[model samples]
Target: MREVFQQELREVQDRLVEIAELVAISIDKATRAFNESDVSLAEEVIAEDPRIDQATVALDELAITILARQQPVARDLRIVVSALRISASLERMGDLSTHISQLARYRFPDKVVPKSLRSTFAEMGALDVEIANKLTSLLRSEDVQLAEEIRNEDDKVDALHLSVFDKVLGEKWKGEAVDTVDATLASRYHERFADHAVAIAKMVQYLATGDWDQSAA
Candidate 1:
């Protein structure tokens, strides 16, 4: 029984790594679609989002089954619980990537943001992609240093998010109302993607350090 339970726990970690890999691919493609106005890539991201959703649902069910069968305690319990929360965050990150692609699809041949803000959005998108990739590594290796790096990148995303607002609200702004709305939504999507990555990193860090404070979440 002990051997079987340990195997189940390893399975949980493996599934998480799989889901994180999907999220990394998602953000990569979504950001490219957003930057290049590639409707086909955008469509791909939207279509594949269901896979991320399904993966998360399956992981949640597996975690619940482990909880019921093994009645995990102490660190074992934390592993199962954190897996659930981390899966949720990864799913949200996937959704945000879909949202970014949706914006690109909506804009179609037209760029999502005006020339003035394109570079900023591009920078934010790159940071989000980097964060997602780092998150996947952190999950697989349990490297707490990656978690801090994720947080730092998230701060950069937040700064860019605010800059988007500042530009749109500034008197010099010349974009149409539609452009304003699109820029705001896209920036938000990018920022939130990084935020979810940070959340997952914190959960992983806490799990590794045995500092399982609920507040770490």
Candidate 2:
């Protein structure tokens, strides 16, 4: 029974890595679509988002089953509980990517942001993609160092997010109402995407080190 329980735990980890990989791909494609105004790619992301949702649902069910059957305690209990929270965060990340792609689709033919803020949005998108990739690695390897790196990248995304607001609200701003709205919404989605990645990284770090404060970095 103990061996079977351990196998279930490994399956939970594998499922998480699989979902993380899907999230990475989603963000990569979503960011590309947002940057280049590729409506087809945007639509592709929107369509595939259901798959990510289904995966998370399945993972949650699995975690619940393990909890009920094995009645895990101590570290085993933490692993199961963390898996549930991590899967929820991953699901939200996928939704944020879809939101980014939706913005691209909404403004098809024209870029989402005006020329003035294009570079800023582009940088935020790139950082989000990088963070998603790093999050996948962190989950698969349980490397606490990767968690710290994710936190640093998330800080960059947060800074970029604030800068977007500052530019839109500045007196020099010239964009129309639609542009302002899109820029704000897009920046928010990008920032929140990184936030979810950081949350997952912290959970992974906690699993590895068993110290929430140490993982809080």
RMSD of each: 1.0, 1.6
Q: What digit string (tens of lDDT, one per residue) describes model 2 on residues 8-51? A: 99899999999999999999999999999999999999999999
Model 2's lDDT to the true fold? 0.93
In order, what lDDT does every prediction score? 0.93, 0.93
Clashing pairs in 1: none
- Candidate 2 residue spans exceeding 4 A from truth: 214-217
Worst window of 10 by summed lDDT in candidate 1: 208-217
Instruction: Score candidate 1 by lDDT.
Output: 0.93
